[model samples]
Target: MMGDTGRRRRSGPRQAAWEFFGAELKNRREEADLTQAELGMRVFVSGGYIGQFEQAIRKPQLDVAQRLDHILQTDGFFERMWRKLIKDSPYADYFAAAAELEALATQICEFAPTVVPGLLQTAPYARAVTIATNPLAADEYVEEKVAARLERAHILKDATRPVYWAILHEGVLRLPVGGRATMAEQLDHIAALMRTRTVLVQVLPNEEGAHAALGGMMTLMEFEDAPPTAYAEALLSGNLLDDPALVKRVQATYDLIRAAALSPEASLALVESAAEDYRRCASTT
Candidate 1:
């Protein structure tokens, strides 16, 4: 019972697992009296790669894991842990950086042109969107994804949470998903969240033609420790940019877009009106 309580006192499962792996790696390397660069040389991996793994920021592949285990004299410890971590996160590479950034973000500003950002999406809406993306996503998979997305939303309610400013294109509200009932519910959810003061939602009307961010959806996250980063994603691939120059360019573009969008007060009114229209439509059918 005492040990169980001690384990419970440790951080959450994901954080705990990462810390455990990191501690083991650090301890083994130190006991071997090897610097990170020295270990990298022996393993034929980059020093940066070694540092990332030790910090648990990146998971290693099988070959890399085996090499680390052999070099650290841990005898397959790295391999087992790597496998477990991968099993726990299927889309790790795709979303891991974003998740880590979200967890520590002090401010998050987003511009979504076509669809509602994932953090603001309702469960039914998220599920419908995910299902439509992949015909092979079974009902259970869709449910799991929806659950994950909703769990991510908890960051907004966190006590010491970040300031979230989201600029959504009017098209998102106009496109009905899961039928009128679901759309109404989703709009109502957004309005309710806005009222809570945790979220600031601005709508970029279609009339604001040819905006600066005609590229795609972008989220700029500012952190307490590292430099700010900008995330841009399409259907197949995503990029995380930390270069100060590039980030400044994106930030300037986002500022312009924000300026062109409706004010928060007006945006909320528009969203509420849309919800009402959807409610009336639902009632008629």
Candidate 2:
């Protein structure tokens, strides 16, 4: 287990608050004379999950926090604290939990049918997407979101963890998000990461008609000590799924989509070619 100082150093001030929550949970659980597994069983989560929560390696959802209040007889203290902590999060309510899990994942596989995945987005592209969805949002709000998205990308710099794999539809390359120059820069960044072996990407070309996961974006995350989970997002809502049966189904769909994508080598060439075309177009403009 990492010390509080180490966790705070890596995750910053927000992490200190979560660490406080974890420490309190640990103290209360011990007072109740409950083993971590016993507490988890009562709360309907795994023992390992309870351990993660206590370590501040994962944050609990509202419902789980409420359950903790009930099981531990904390008089709603956990629930109230949870609401306060989540309210301060920069990510969308639907995405905050998933974003936390992304840091702890051992492997992440994403399928993007429209725009580039947030982890792969450049600042310009992220800003464009933010504005596209919230055209009336204040500039400060937009910049905050772009900064948060870019911060998530830093996980890739770790060099020794969370093997990232992404499959982007061909349309994602040609979307001209933020304009030709921005799209060119985005593609170039992805190509550079591919060349450095920082991430693996495959393109699901337009020619591969009617592929699986055509509905929206899906991410499957594998953890070192916990069961794998799947996340699917559409429009305004997102769902994180941990049920073994549901995760298995999500995994199967991802496998099918991966099968339909171009080989990594071919995909890199396609991405580079697309970037060149955008650069050419931008030069003319």
Candidate 3:
């Protein structure tokens, strides 16, 4: 397995192109005598979001790009640029937008009922999950996926990283993902991060019964300048919600789930205990 050096590089020709796109957008908007907010209003996105696009911190979807092209009278230049850059995304089409926003968020809260969130997954655990989902996937594809996931995790290591919080269900700890040894390492990693005060974690016990956000996984993110957004994922597809009412409701559901979860200290104990159990099983085998 590759260490930090093996992390997928997000720079190169594509990075240069993204920067150019941002610069061109900014120049065109100025030439048109339009403020960022005015341009965003014509394109049906928030002014902050437009600024993010201009700064290359976030990517725009195809529809949004088309809108931008129309507003700027660029004769589909933005759309063409978007098409070329989009083909390089490692994430699924449904999740690419949310992933982009993740790097720009100031705070992130996740409710994970089945598996650990991607931002917290170790390489082994991430590889195991990827291969399980695509049993016939080629080795190159698996490695690419694992590398992409690890790259995403690197955001947590950044000095300006968001305040991250996660609530995991009891079953997430009990499930022996990647076998005992891998699970042991995974839990230990989480515990270690908690000890360093890098992240806050809580666990919802099985006895808690059903909850408002139990049926699916929810990720809520708050940005420094942009409006808040929420993402929900299921078997294959995911939805990113930006509407004020919808985001507020998702936030409320997350708050409810958090209230029902064990305290952070107790959750650490449970996670450490689970790691010990796996260590023993791994040793025996």
Candidate lDDT scores, in order, read 0.79, 0.89, 0.86
**Top candidate by TM-score:** 2
The TM-score of predicted model 2 comes to 0.92
TM-scores of the candidates are 0.78, 0.92, 0.87
Candidate 2: residue 162 lDDT (0-100)? 74
Instruction: Give the per-residue lDDT of model 2 (tens digit) for 195-284.
Output: 999999999999885894455799999866567989999998899888789999989888888999999999999999999999999999
Query: Candidate 1, which ten residues in sequence have the lowest lDDT sum?
Result: 1-10
> Model 1 over residues 1-285: C-alpha lDDT tens digits?
112322332247776787688778878989999998999788876666577667654444567779988987887989898777756862445565566556656789999888788889999888778888876978888888888888788878766667999998888898997888889999999999998988999999989868834668899998553467788877756777765788999898899999899999999999999999999999999
Q: Which stretches of candidate 3 lie over 4 Å from their true place?
A: 1-15, 30-33, 212-215
Ranked by lDDT, the better of candidates 1 and 2 is 2
Which residues of candidate 2, in runs, are more than 4 Å off? 1-10, 213-215
Encode model 3's per-residue lDDT on 1-285: one tens digit a residue.
Answer: 212321233355765787799999999999999999998889888887788778776677788899988888999999988876766779887887788778667789999999999999999999999999999999999999999999989878976678999999999999999999999999999999999999999999988758734558899998765678899999888998887999999988888889999999999999999999999999999
TM-score of 3: 0.87
Ranking by lDDT: 2, 3, 1
